[model samples]
Target chain A: MDGMVLVITSGKGGVGKTTTVANIGAALAALGRRVVLVDADIGLRNLDVVMGLENRIVYDIVNVMENKDLPVRKALIKDKRVESLFLLPAAQTRDKDAIKPEQMKELCEELRQEFDYVLIDCPAGIEQGFRNAVAGADLALIVTTPEVSAVRDADRIIGLVEAEGLRGPRLILNRLRPDMVKRREMMDIEDVLDILHIDLLGVVPDDEAIIISTNKGEPIAFDNNSKAGQAYRNIARRLEGEEVPFQSFDNPSFFQRLRQLVGMDK
Target chain B: MALLDFLSRVLNRDEGSKETAKQRLQLVLVQDRASVNPHLLEELKEDLIGVISRYLEIDLSAMEINLESGGGDTVALVANIPVRQVRRSQQK
Candidate 1:
C-alpha cells in the first residue's frame, strides 16, 4: 500500500514544527501504525534530538541518496517504546542545496512502499530546504503558533502547497494560550482559522511539559496529562480521519465541574 | 465580592471571543499571502494618485483604504469618493 507522506512544516522557525512531528509520529505509532519520521531539515537537523533518537543516528536520507554502504533499515532508528515508530535523521554535514526536489520525492516513494505514514520534518524559510522538504509529500501539515509572524509564513506556505497541486494544507495551531486569548491580550483560535481558512487538524495548548519532554528526549504525547501532549494525540487521530472532540482549552475547569443539584421543596 | 465578580464577568465577557483566533489568523494570512505591508500599501496609493489624475477627475483627498479582518465590525474595505459633491456642483 502507498504510504501517506505528510510533511510537517511552518515557514517560520521556533513554532513547534519538530515538536508536532515527534509527538504526532509517536502518537500514530502508539495507535498501531507503522510510521517513519524523516528529518529533511538537512545540516540543521533537530528532529532526531526532539524524537530522542539523536545518539542512535548512523545513516540518514543523505546517506541513502549518496549510495553509501549504510542500509536504509539501519539508518532507521526504531523506538523501543513505540514498536512501529522509526526516525530517519537528516545529514548534519550536507546543506539543503545538496539534494534536489525530485530526489526527495523518490526517497519518499521508496519509504512509502515500506511504511504507513511518512512524516517529513521540513526546515524553516521558503528556500531550497522548504522546497526539498515538500517535494515528495502527498499532504502538508502546516504548523503555526498564535503569533502573527508564524501565521503569516504559514499562509505563504499553504499557498505554495496548493500551487504544488497538493491538497489545501491542514493547520496545527501550536503553543496556544487560551487564558491569554480570553483576556483579549492575545489572539484566539477562531481569529487564526478565519485567516488561514483551512480545516483545523488540532489545537495544542501552551504547556511546559513540551519543553521538559524535549529536554528528556521524550515526546509529550506519552505524558497524557499536559494539554499540549493531548493535543498532539488528537492531531494524530484527526490525521487518521477519526472524529476527535477538541477540548475547550479556555475552560479547563469545566471537566472538573459538576453543577450541584439544589433541592427544591415540592 | 459577588457584585465585583459579577461586574467583571459581565463587562469583560466577549460573546464573539471564540472566533478571535480564526479572525486574527485570517487578517495575518491575507497580509502574508499578499507580501504587501501597510507602508507599501500607502506607497501604492500615492503612486496611484499620479497615474489616476492624468485623465479622470478624481477625489485625491477622500481616498480611504485599509486591510480588513472579519469579525464583521470593521473587516471590509471602506472607500469614499468626492464624485457626488463635484457632480452636484456641476449640475447646479
Candidate 2:
C-alpha cells in the first residue's frame, strides 16, 4: 500500500466521482502529504473545473505522454489552497484513446516516486476511458448514491475492478438523506450495503452547500464547515487508513428512534 | 423478525413518513442495474412454464425461477427446475 494509486470510478454518470477526487485531494494535501489528482476523463474532463484550475491547463496527460520535452513537474497543477496538492489534467480536445493503459501505468509510476498519493478521477462508462484510468491504480473507490441505479453501476464497476487484479473498492454512499431512510420511503443504508456488500468508507448527506461550492468552482471539502464537507474529509482520513467514527444525521423524530431501536434498518 | 423490527424502528424514528422522491429514484436505479423489469420477470415465468412442460410430466404450475440483482456486476439466476418422470399412462 505504499505510494497508493487510487481510482475513483462509477460506471454510472453523475455519482460525484470527480467531486470526490477534488475534495479528497484537497483534504489529503492539506494534511501535508504530497498528492496528485489525475483526471483520466480525457475529453469529458471536469476535475480541472472542479478544482478551479481550468484556466491554468496548458499541457494535459496526453501532452505529457506525447511531448517528451515537457517535464512532469510542469504538467502538475498545484492547488492554490494547498501547497502539497497538484493535478494532472486530461486532454479536453482529444478522446479517451489519447493515452493507453501502459502509458497511464508509467505516468502513475513516475507520480508514485514524487507523490504520496495519486488519485485518478475516472470517467463514467466501462469502456477505454475506464481501462486507462484504472491501469496503474492500486485501489479503487466506488462512488454511489443511496439510489439503486448508482449502486448497480457501482457493483458492476466493483466486479471489473476485481477482475483487473485490484482490491478494496470501498463504498461511498453519497447524496443520502437520513430523513428519507427513516420513513421506510427510501432504501435504508443497510439495504444498500446488503446489495453491494462492500466495506463502508463514509456516507455523505446531500447538502445544498455542495451545489454552491460546485458552482463557485471551489470544493466543499475546503470549507471545513459544511456537513458534506466534513463527510469528504472523513473519507480522506479513512483513505489514509485512519479510523474515524461517523457522525449521525441527527434526526430524532419518533421513527428515527424506532429505526435505531430496530437496529439501524437501512 | 429482525428485519421487521429494524423497519419498525426506522418508521418510528421518522414519524412513520413515506420515502422521499430521491429515495425512490435510488431504488429504481438498483432495479435497473439488475436489468430486471418486473414485467420481464413475469414473462420469463410464463415462458419457463411452456418450455418445461413441453416434454416433461413435472408440475409446471409449481415451478419458480427468480432473477436477483447481485449488487452492480451480475444478474444472478435462482431457478427451481423441478422435474418428474413421464408415466407410461399418458403415452397413448
Best by DockQ: 1
Who wins the TM-score comparison?
A: 1
Q: What is the TM-score of chain B in candidate 1?
A: 0.39
Encode model 2's per-residue lDDT on B1-92: one tens digit a residue: 96896687767664332344334445545556445346767787878766656656676656777766566544567888668865555342
Candidate 1 C-alpha RMSD relative to the actual structure: 6.8
List the DockQ of the predictions in order: 0.23, 0.19
> Where does the lowest 10-residue lDDT sum fall in candidate 1 chain B?
B83-92
Per-residue lDDT of candidate 1, residues A30-140 (tens digit): 899999999999999999888888888787888888775666888899986899999999999999988899999888998999999999999999889989999999999
Per-candidate Cα lDDT values, in order, are 0.81, 0.83
| Residue A60, model 2, lDDT | 89
Clashes of each: 19, 26
Q: What are the runs in model 2 whose C-alpha is more than 4 Å off?
A: A251-266, B1-92
* Candidate 1 C-alpha error for residue A25, in Å: 0.2
The digit string of per-residue lDDT tens for model 1 on B9-70 reads 68977443435545555555555554534566678677766655554567777776655564
